[model samples]
Target chain A: MHSIPGRRLIMGLFLIFLLLPIYWLVNMSFKTNAEIVSTMTLWPHTPTLQHYKRIFTDESWYSGYINSLEYVVLNTIISISVALPAAYAFSRYRFLGDKHLFFWLLSNRMAPAAVYALPFFNLYSAIGLFDTPWAVALAHCIFNVPLAVWILEGFVSGVPREIDETAFLDGYSFPRFFIKILVPLIASGIGVAAFFCFMFSWVELLLARTLTSVHAKPIAAIMTRTVSAAGMDWGLLAAAGVLTIIPGALVIWFVRNYIASGFALGRV
Target chain B: MDKTVNQKAWFLVLPVFLVVAFSAVLPLMTVVNYSMQDTFGNNQFFWNGVGWFKELLDPSTDLGGRFLASLGRNLFFSMVILAIEVPLGIVVALSMPRQGWTVAACLVILALPLLIPWNVVGTIWQIFGRPDIGLLGYVLNAIGIDYNYVSNEIDAWVTVIVMDVWHWTSLVALLCYAGLKSIPEAYYQAAQIDGASRWAVFKAIQLPKMNRVLLIAVLLRFMDSFMIYTEPFVVTGGGPGNSTTFVSIELVKIALGQFDLGKAAALSLVYNLIILIVCWIFYTVMTNAGVERKVQAESEPAAKPKSSAALKPATALKPKEGVA
Candidate 1:
């Protein structure tokens, strides 16, 4: 506990810096545009839920959240399922092009979402997958799948080969051993990986926004258009921003340890 | 550690290959196709044949000048971020409490800014920096400092840079903390026994151990910062007279906003090539680091598990699989 005061000071300063914008957004969300512009109070004066009320009651506003959730869930499921077997292979075996294959997968992650935005818009339309959640879900895989594979490969590699040999000796089929034995063993790895897949898919907007229109428009797109269309509804925009953060905050709380430790295990 | 040379393992990777190929390759091929042609509406394209590419690469041309300017801005942004975040991250990671309840608390707080969607981050900051309404803007003005991110170019840049630092420094700090956590206590004990100074211990032990994680942090930050679009877009709209127009922002303007598909495609290919080259550079650097560390192990009998443990868990703690 020596130098406890110093530690407290540094932590205090850092946390305040970290939370200020978030606090302000939340504060602004409770104030009307008039109060927000005219009065500069740390706390909302005449606190109102009108901004949030507008979002909740409006179909365009609320459906944007639903649309975002729809694709993010789909992408997470798709990324994890495909990445599992692929990650398993890279971990356990020396296949042809295995090294090259892994690098290739990761480079796809390095591909800027902007670089592919226009082409994806074209390709999705060509394949008749445009204007739907599937387009964004599938588009997000370009990055999410690579990340999932890398993280899963880490936990997979940590698994001892003797376990596989023992399962075979115990007369378990490959699929049976994999499902009944291997998967149950690395459930944390799956949890960690799924959480990250969900995170990346949820946050992405360039690909998501470009790939979808009204039928599958994301909350982020809705947020941006609101600014341009209705002029800056600072209160409404602030409320939307605050709402978008809740799901992410909840996810972070759930996977705080996994993200901290999982990166240590998975990447470097 | 020796494994079977199974040819059938390709089957396992097939689905991943197909899905990613569908997602990555087909559009990439479209980008390639578009780059080589000129489209003048009505879904008609003529064989421009490197004309757009020529215009894109030559800084003298109108499109090329825009591309070059934005590319320079993006590079500058990446450089500035690396400069600020890398050192700040190390200091923060060092200050972080290594054990007890604080670990979870620190992780959750640090993780908050990162998990926010990019556009929301922009919106949050946009409001936070408003002169009339924003706390930051209001506070700065109250303090008699001139600050207006809306109209001033330098202010816009500073605001964008600060927002990025706030949003991403935690990622670097978190990665560094993980690296610091993996350092075996024996290294410290050995240093203390030798009467090494704190700087000496950090130089010889902590710095080397952090090299790999630092590489990961740097590469990830570099790529992400270079490709930044949405956050800055929402905040400034690349405004104040193209002061904040990054390549991605410029590309979108050309391709989607202006409907200049051919020029956008050409520019996209160039951008992709640059990013690929960066990835290659970092990949090779990391691989060489791995190989050099391996060579050092082979030459020194003192190196533990010299021949193996080079890839997974080189100096990392083995992840607990007993959780299940």
Candidate 2:
């Protein structure tokens, strides 16, 4: 192999390029709003925990966390439950309209969420499901189900047919075989699928912003209103942004080990 | 793998089908309904019968201009994103450590930007690009380049594009990395034995092997860039004389800001059709190529035993034409 210093230099520079914005974000989050706007300080001169304090103590700020958590859980659970069987069917069996159906499902993923946003708002409003957690949870499934199905199908296909046959020979019913044997085998796949579902629903803003007025909105939606009354609370906004990164970061950290071979398994 | 049908299994797929249908089919039906009818503040819809579509497609109207301009921008933006991200992603993936904890750490860091919510990404860039306070902005101004995303069209476009590239480049990288990782070492060994140049090895061996994953990467990037909304919307709000306005932003303005439901629905449907058509074309081409590859791989006589093992593992297991 070539020990190219040139390649190493380029890679190092790329790494720094990738991390600079993040460093800037972290640096700004620690600074006082005055310093943020008034002076060009790369590092905070007078770094304070006041923003962090406000995010924790303030009702409006903390409420965003609660709303986001509530809906993300609901969305993940609903999406995965539906996706598992569909994925299994696609992976294990040759069926009627199988290719067409699989393609159709994937095509849903390509549909811009924007196309349906207005219609969804109207539909949810008409059905009186507007401004609610369930509405966001349900709406998320539009993209998540297709994604979940696609990922899970990949994982399930990798599990050999003999495993199912052995379980059946052991007198396990199809559901029993699937639950007791198949699910355990594809546990990592399910984990990857779950993480994706959580990530997508968690980060989504447009429908989250449009659907709810106040009561049942996610943190991403609440972040929009952080500017009101206090003339753009940059401190609190930065704090909230930092805090929002925690759950996702944690999820990614946990899922990182599984990611490499997970996709290879036809799952992630 | 047997043809023996389990009719009871439909029950399992039923819940998911119903949920997805409710979310997807219902809203779609609603859009269809709205596109064909006009409402005048009483919740009563009158038959419009393609009138809104006619007006939306008419060249004289601002609505038409807004739609066309945004669509053009989106197409261009998607192309720019594809050009930068795909090649860059592939290069990064190629350079990645072939094994161990370093590879894991790199993957995690690459995924960090992807984890952040789109709005926060917008916020991060919005504040980070301020000439008065933002690091990039301040540095650029100090260097005498008067940078301002809020007012400058070029700056806004660059910021939006950069933000997207930063956010999504990892996805392409990760996908390509998967493709590369699946390439058997024997091929590299053979290339080394043959004393092939690095460029030749990559072009002949790596690129050909990565076709399927690359297909996936391109399709995903195209779909994502085409429908991109949140980051640009929050950062630029499609401002500076609508220079940065992409299709989604325009759609939102027409649908929500102007409250033109019928026309918005019509425009939405048109946008959906464009995406659908493009995606269909990509899908068809990729699948056809995949089929060709499978046939070629199977039909070709044993070229070299070394080459056989060196062949990509991904190509080995891909569907034989209709398997997907």
Q: Please give each candidate's TM-score.
A: 0.93, 0.93
Which residue pairs collide in model 2, if any? A154-A266, A155-A266, B187-B310
**TM-score attained by chain A of model 1:** 0.95
- What is candidate 2's lDDT per residue for B116-225, written digit by digit as tens? 99999999888788787677888998999989999999999999998888898888878877777766677776566656656656766778767778887888889888
Which 10-residue window in model 1 chain A sums to the lowest lDDT? Answer: A1-10
Off by over 4 Å in 2: A1-5, A261-268, B1-9, B289-308, B311-324
Q: Whose lDDT is greatest here?
A: 1
Q: For residues A28-57, write the lDDT of model 1, one tens digit per residue.
A: 899888888777888987999998999999
How much is the lDDT of residue B314 in candidate 2?
25
Instruction: Give the C-alpha miss distance for residue B244 in model 1, angstroms.
Output: 0.9
- In candidate 1, position B191 carries an lDDT of 51
lDDT of each: 0.86, 0.80
Q: Model 1: per-residue lDDT, tens digit, B181-212?
A: 77767666545545555555556667787898
